[model samples]
Target chain A: MSARDDILGSVRRSLRRDRLSDEAQAALQRRIRAHERNIVPQRGSGSGAEIAARFIDEAKSVAVTVQPVASDAEVPDAIVRYLAQHNLPARVAMAPSAALEQIPWASRPTLEVRRGAARPDDQVSVTPAFAGIAETGTLMLTSGAETPTTLNLLPYDHVVVMRTSQIVGSYEDAWDLLRQSRSRADGLIDMPRTVNFITGPSRTGDIEQKILMGAHGPRRLHIVLIEDA
Target chain B: MESTSHRFKENAREGMANPSLQRAMENMRRGFPDKRLAAIGRLPEFDALRDRARDIKNHVLEHLDFYLEAWEAKVTAAGGHVHWCRDAEEARRTVLAICRRLEARTVTKGKSMIAEEIALNPFLEANGIEPIETDLGEYIIQIRNEPPSHIIAPAIHLTQDDIEKSFRASHRQLDPGRPLSEPHQLLDEARSLLRDKFIAADVGITGANFLIAETGSSVIVTNEGNGDLTQTLTKAHIVVTSLEKVVPTLEDAQTILRVLARSATGQDYSVYTTVSTGPRRPEDLDGPGEYHVVLLDNGRSRMLGTEFHDMLRCIRCGACMNHCPVYATVGGHAYGWVYPGPMGAVLTPSLIGVDEAGHLPNASTFCGKCESVCPMRIPLPRMMRHWREREFERHLSPAASRYGLGLWAFLAKRPRLYRLVNGLMARVLGLLGREHGGFRHLPLAGGWTGGRDMPAPEGEGFHQAWARKRRERTRAA
Candidate 1:
């Protein structure tokens, strides 16, 4: 027998059963399909403004800098000001998503914006997040043609552009959004190749249990939160 | 990987005497538990979530074969391959075959206890594949040629000076005078040094925190982004995880994640939780072109339906060890395997046999702190007792312990004789130690009295005192 059959057979013998009956399999399938939420924390549940506020506060507490902009047009200026404030280079490896294309990068002529996956030498990256999780101040980014997963890593600095409308109260809410957004006509969930829930800049407490930021990933995580979506 | 576990007493003695290891453990005891308390304090639903997490795992374990088959179908549909390995050797062979097929020279790895269990690095190096550990803690220990001292914090046994010395010796090309004073400077050096390896590696190997059977995705939770970089930059990505990691759906994964980081590092959430479903799509700009999942059993399947079955609920949070008195004192290395602490005490014997790893179960104090703090609520103390019972039943326990237990059983069954002998001994010891109120040395209890004086018994034994107290209470009533 193959290793798969041998292992599965052993599991069945240990579990005291052969292949599960049809009724049992159906019940298991139903549980997975239901995708029920268990004990969603009360902390992140609130109105739109309240949820967005909590998201910002939670993000800030974890050492991520959050800037609330009034509109999409303000994003370019926000990025430019943030770069200048931090003394970072004006060059950015921006994700070429349709939502990000709405921003007026031309207004910031001094900035060198390269729209593609981040390169090995890229110092900074700017990507539009799919959603902001209010519970833990996490940004949800999915891999796709326009948004390469590399931009989320490899770079020393990561600047995420998100809107208040994209903020969700919990991780369960984010999963619901993902399922609804990616549901196919055949009733299957076309899950993304990769989904990253990044809460803060990369850090490690490996050496003497001392926390240090920028360990093999972005050191600085700056969020440009658009207030008026 | 090698079992020095039979010499646990000596290993623990060495561990306790090592000043640097003691200092490092002191820092960990001060840091991890308090942070976990604060993190859990912020969420009112934390305990409720733990219960939900435990139930979800229980449900999956009962129907594990069903879930694995379902998960295999999802992975196949997503264009990913799943390999089933019965033990460590097959697991290693499967991984090496994939790497060889990809023509991989150098592979970058994220921190994985499973990788340590299989001893993948040595196997790969022997096969001419250079495996570079990407997690900072793993990198530090890997260069020093040591196994992870702690599951989450691999270099928790080392001091900052040790790391600086290791870096100086390994990265000899760099300037010798460069300041490595602060932790950030070390981080910067490692970041720059590893950046090239991440970009140039042919394959990336990582362990899964949870495998979502619903989406056929492997989830990796880490503080550093090395896991992301490892999977994204390499041409092929391989997940080497065990059977128990699989959960039924994304929601199930979320329920467990809610408690994972808070228990592990006291964070509301880890810095990065990345879920990878399969290989990169045709439209994708950058990701691993090939993806494979290796499911390892390694005696775990046999653990099912046994007394040790509850050990499968472990999330590798390190909370049990963080709060374990034995772990806090002797640190992780003394348990002498890939796992350590309360969890390791119960698990080591099951994986490595009761004879070889029997001493680990005897190392616990059974204070019940581990079970109280366990997010999965595994009855860790009870499980350790079970291992002890198994050892005794198999005659794997030492001759002295067996003789001691035989005497105990004999005395315990004869209550009248036991109380009579106890009273006589108490009276004699009480009179003999009237001056000091304790014995400086004893005949048979040299091990107990070696470190400190053993307190003498009171004038009256426990039975006499209890009988007098009861009579007084009856008279008062």
Candidate 2:
């Protein structure tokens, strides 16, 4: 017998069942299809503005820098200012998302921005988030031609622009949004190649349990929150 | 991978004596439990979530075969492959096949204990392939040529000075005077040294925190994001994980994730929780072109429906060890295997065999802290007791202990003789210890009184004291 059959057979013997009954199979299928939620925390529940405020506060608590701006047009200016303040280069590897491309980057002629996936040579990368979860101060990013997962990982400085309206109260809300998009009437979520939930800058407590940031990922995570846009 | 579990007593003595190991163990004992308490303190529903997490795992284990089959179909549908490996040798061979097929000369690996279980690094090096461990902790141990003493904090056994010495010796190309004194500097050095490896490795291997059947997703819970870099930059991504990690859906994954990070590191959530569905999609700009899941069943299926079946619910959180008194003193390496602590004590016997690892189950103080902190609510002490019983049944216990238990059992059955002997012994000990009230040493209990004194029995036997009290009460009435 194949290793698969041998192992499964052992499991069946141990479980004292030759095979799954029809009722058991049907119940499991229903649970998978329903994808029911269990005991989601109440910490993320509030009004939109309140949730956004909580997002900023919670994000800051986890060592994330959040800058709430008035419009999408100010995002370029905000990035420019943040880079200048940190004494970084005025360059970015911007994602090829339409939402990011529509930003008025032409207004800032001095800034050098390239649109593509992250490069080893790229010092900074700006990627648009699919959603912001306020409960844990997390940014949910999807992989695609536009988002291209590397932007969130390879850059030294990562600047994410998330609209206040896109910020939800919990991970459940974000997952629900993902499930609703492109479902084939079977309640199955057509997940992207990858969905990354990033809470803060990359860190490690490996060395004698001392937390050191910038370990093989971004050193600084700056969120340019577009509020009242 | 060799069993030093039989030499646990000696290993524990050395572990406690080493200044560096003691210092590291002290830090864990002081920090982790308090941090877990504070993290859970903020969430009122933390205990309820643990219950839900237990139910979810119990459901999965009951229908493990069905879930694994369903998950394999979904993985194949998503343009990936699943290899069923019965043991460590098969798992190693399967990984080698994938690497040879890809012509992989350099393999970048994330932190996976399954790799440790198979002893993959040496096997790869012998086969003329270089395997670079990318997690900061794993990298530290890799340089030092040591197995991880702790699962999560692989380098916790080493002091900062130790790391500085290893870095200087390993990275000879870097300037010797680069002020590599601080943890941040050490981290920066590793980050730069490994960035090129991420780009250069032909294949990347990682362990899954959870494998979802609904969307064919393998979730990685990390704080440093090196696993993401290791997988995303490689041409092919291979997941070296076990069968018990499979969950039924994304929602079930979320339920476990809610409790996992909090229990492990006192974090509300790990920094990066990435769920990979398959290889890079057609429209995706960058990701691995190939994806493979090696589902290892190394002795886990046989453990099902036994006294030790609940051991499969382990999420590798490291909390049980964090709160285990035996672990706090001996550290992880003394358990002498891939796993350690209360979980290891129970699991090692079942996986390796009680005869080889019988001492591990006997190393516990039965403080019940491990069970109290366990997110999956595994009865760790109860399972350890089961191992002891199995050892006794097999005549694997020491002759002295067997004879002692035999004597006690014989005496316990005769109540009249038991009380008479007990009264005589208590009177003798009471007279002997009247001056000091304790004994510094004893005849057969040298192991017990080797380090400390044993308190003497007080006054009369229990039956005599009860009778005297009853007569005095009657006279007063």
Candidate 3:
């Protein structure tokens, strides 16, 4: 017998069922289709400014540096200031997202911005987050033509420019937003090739349980939180 | 992958004796449990979430075949392939076949206990395909040519000095004067060295934290983001995970994720929780061109309706081991396999066989700490007892233990005889040990007294003391 058949057959024998009953199949399908939420944490379940404040607090606790920009126009100046503070380079690989591309990089003459996917040598990369989860201060990033996944993984310093309005109270809220936005004709959510929920810069406690940041990904994660409604 | 599990007593002795291993285990004992408690304390819904997570897994396991079929259809719909393997040999061959077709010379791998279970690196290297572990812990152990001592912390048995020595010996390009005193410096060295390998690797393999049947998405939770780098940069991404990892939907996966990171490393969320749906889409500029999921059974199917079925609910959080006294004392290597501690005690026997791994179950003290901390609420002590019973029934237990139990069983059938023998023995031992308050040596219990003194029994037997107490109470009334 084929491995698949043999394995399935064994499982069936153990379960004492020859095949899935019509009722059983329907129930299982219903469970998948419903995709119900279970016990969302109350800590990040607040709304409005509370969620944003909670997000910043949680983010800062994990050693993420959050800069609350007053508006979208202030993003460029904020990035420059952050880079200068961290002693990072003027060069950055920016994602081609409309929100990021609209930023007036021309105003900053000293900054060198390369658009599209990040190169291996790129020291800093700026990408727009799809959402910010308030529960864990996680940035929800999706891979696309505009937001190349490499921009999230290949750089030493990662700058995420997300608005306060983009921050959700919980992971379930974020999932609901995704399902609403990307529902296909078949009713299944058309997920991106990759959806990364990044809470902080990459870290490793592998060596003697001493946490050292930037093991394989970004060493510094700078969030320019634009206070936009 | 070889079973030193049979010689668990000897392995445990060496594990305890090794100064470095003892030091590493001490750090683990101090670190994981406290952090987990703090993480869970932050969330009021932690226990409720764990309950829901257990229910979801139980539901999935019950309808596993149905979910597997549904998940496969979804995977194919999303332009991915699903390979089914009955055993480790088939799983290894399936991975090799994929690499051969891709003409992959070097493969970058994320941390996978499944890979360790199959001994993938050696097999791939023998086939002239180099497999590089990208996770920091796995990387350290890989270079050292040693199996992971801990599941989550693979090189938890090694010290910073050991890592520095390994790097210096293997990385000949390193300057003699370069500072390697700090963990940061070691991390940076590995990061820079592995970056080129990540870029150069033709195939990238990873293990799935959970496979969603809803959208054919495979979820990976990692603190270091090596998994993301491994899967994204390569031409093909091969996920070598067991069949039991599948959940019904993304929401179900999320419920498990809520408890997973907290239980594993005390993080509310890992630094990176990435969900990959098949290969990269047509419009995607990055990610792998091909996606394959190798669904490995390897004896899990037989565990479906058995007494050990709850063992499948493990999410590999390592919480059970973290809280286990036996694990804290001897460390992960003493269990002698890819998995360790209470989970391994129950699971190794089922996967490898009780005959080969009988000593693992016997290694536990039935402390029940592992069960209390287990997110799935797996009755670990009960399963270990089951294994002991199985061993005794099959006569796989040592003759000494069987004979001792046989003598107790024989005497216990007759209460008068049992009481007479016990009363005499207790008085004799109590009188003998009145000075030291314990025995330094014993005839039948050499194993118990080998390491520490066994406390002496009281002078009177339990029945004699109980009768005396009852008579005194009646007279007073």
Candidate with best lDDT: 1
Q: Is the docking of candidate 3 incorrect, acceptable, medium or high quality?
A: high
lDDT of 2 by residue, B175-234 (tens): 998998988999999998899999999999999999998888899989999999989999
Cα lDDT, all candidates: 0.92, 0.89, 0.92
lDDT of 1 by residue, B1-477 (tens): 787788888889999999999999999999999999999999989999999999999998999999999998999899999999999999999999999999999999998889999999999999999999999999999999988889999999999988999999999999999999788888899999999999889999999999888889999999999999999999999999999999998888998999999999999999999999999999999899999999999999999999999999999999999999999899899989999999988888889888888989888878999999999999999999998898889888768768887997898899999999889989999888888999999887777687679788887799999999999999999
Which structure is stronger by DockQ: 1 or 2? 1
Quote the TM-score that chain A achieves in each candidate.
0.97, 0.97, 0.97
In model 3, which regions exceed 4 Å deviation? Answer: B471-477
Interface RMSD of 1: 0.7
Cα lDDT of model 3 by residue, B186-240, tens digit: 9989999999999999999999989999898899999899999999999999999
- Model 3 / residue B23 / CA error / Å: 1.0
Tens digits of lDDT, candidate 3, A137-158: 8889999889899999899899
- Please give, for every candidate in the order listed, the TM-score of chain B alone compared with the true chain B: 0.98, 0.96, 0.98
TM-score of each model, in listed order = 0.99, 0.97, 0.98
